[model samples]
Target: MITSLDHLVLTVADIDATIAFYTQALGMTHAPFTVADGSTRHALRFGESKINLHVSGAEFEPKAQNPTAGSADLCFLTDRPLADWQRHLAAHGTRIEEGPVPRSGATGPLISLYVRDPDGNLIEISAPLQP
Candidate 1:
């Protein structure tokens, strides 16, 4: 059985833009690392969690079952409030795809703000509601 999610892969239409959006808007750091095949992969790291970016159309082994850009819908929990995420997105000229609405998180209640990355991937930024 799985204990927790370690990392996830995102097939990106544009790797540079994806890196910029996550690093600049979401406060994540870009960590470029090389695989065993001597190819480099771009990733965004926040603490122990990370999201690896694979350029669409590039050949890579051991990938997602459905590795299509803009196909993933993911939620990220933050200690910062939804308002903060909203502000960051607005400042970066990133449009809110949905809203800062109430939503149910996997472990608890949450308030989430939705946005689309350059690849049009649905990104849900969430803050946990106080118990």
Candidate 2:
């Protein structure tokens, strides 16, 4: 059984653009590392989680059967309120596809905002509802 998520790989069209979006818009940190083959690869770090970047058609060995962009729907928890997220996204020129709508989260009810990344991945940023 999995204890907790360590990292996930994202098949992206442009690594630099993806990095810029996550770092600037989402406040994640960029971490570039050298692999076993001595090739440099990039990742976006937030909290204890990281998303590894792999260019489409040049993915590492043992990748997903159909590694495609724009196919993933990911949700992330935040301490900030939904209103603050709206302004932040606007300031960064990132569009919100939908919501401050209510949805069920892993723990309980949440208020979430949906946005798209450079690769068109659906990213839901949620804040847990207070009692």
Candidate 3:
């Protein structure tokens, strides 16, 4: 049985670009750290979770069979409304790939805004619709 997720590995083309996009658009913080092999790696921290940035082919070891960019589609819950996220994304020069449309999330009714990260990963920002 699996518990809650700790982190997700993101295979990216450029680490700096990924950092810039996530931090500037999503308000995540850059958390760079050294691995056991003395190699430096970067992560984007939000709330209690983080995404470990793994440069394609330069990943630590025992990685995916084929690591590629723009492969992740992750949804993050937000307290703010869809309009607020639209403005926020616009301020950061992020294009909304899709909607402020209605959808069903794990908790129930949701309003989501889609944006692409530097690697073209689909990042969905959602807010649970109040009952």
Candidate 4:
């Protein structure tokens, strides 16, 4: 039914911090966008999906008070999935809980690993074989 994972949204406390963490730590480039209100959202491009981090100054209170961890898992296409993640995470001091598992689901078979972002949100890095 689903063609591919398009994007994932995350509500974070520190917008710049989250941006820096993903850009510097995970090697993602912040893509350009338009912000309608004073509130803003950042889109970082990593392979196919764009990880979005939104900031809504005081309008949304729940995200500021209570944050969710590992609510969503994201994957990136890489030539060396495991090695690239290992070096990147190590350089940024991010620890891996579990990893590099061969997942089987509707998305098909893929090699993946899991990690958390600055706000403790879970992320997956997967390399899907050619169809």
Give me the candidate number with maximum lDDT: 2
User: What is the C-alpha local distance difference test score of candidate 1?
Assistant: 0.86
| TM-score on alpha carbons, each prediction | 0.92, 0.97, 0.95, 0.69
How does each model score on lDDT? 0.86, 0.94, 0.90, 0.70
Q: In model 4, what are the clashing residue pairs, if there are any?
A: none
Writing each residue's lDDT as its tens digit, candidate 3 over 40-112 gives: 8899999889999899768867788888999999999998888988998998889998999898998699999
| Candidate 1 vs. true structure, TM-score | 0.92
Candidate 1 structure quality by residue, lDDT tens digits, 1-131: 98888888999988899999888878899999998889787889987889988889883778877789989899888998777778878898988888778899999889888888888888899888997
- In model 2, the runs with Cα more than 4 Å from the true position are none
Question: Which structure is stronger by TM-score: 2 or 4?
Answer: 2
Point out where model 1 deviates above 4 Å: none
Cand. 2 Cα-lDDT: 0.94
For model 2, how does the per-residue alpha-carbon lDDT over 6-69 read when each residue is reduced to its tens digit?
A: 9999999988999999999999999999989999989999999999988998998889999997
Tell me the tens digit of each residue's lDDT in model 4 across 16-39. Answer: 887887898778898857666565
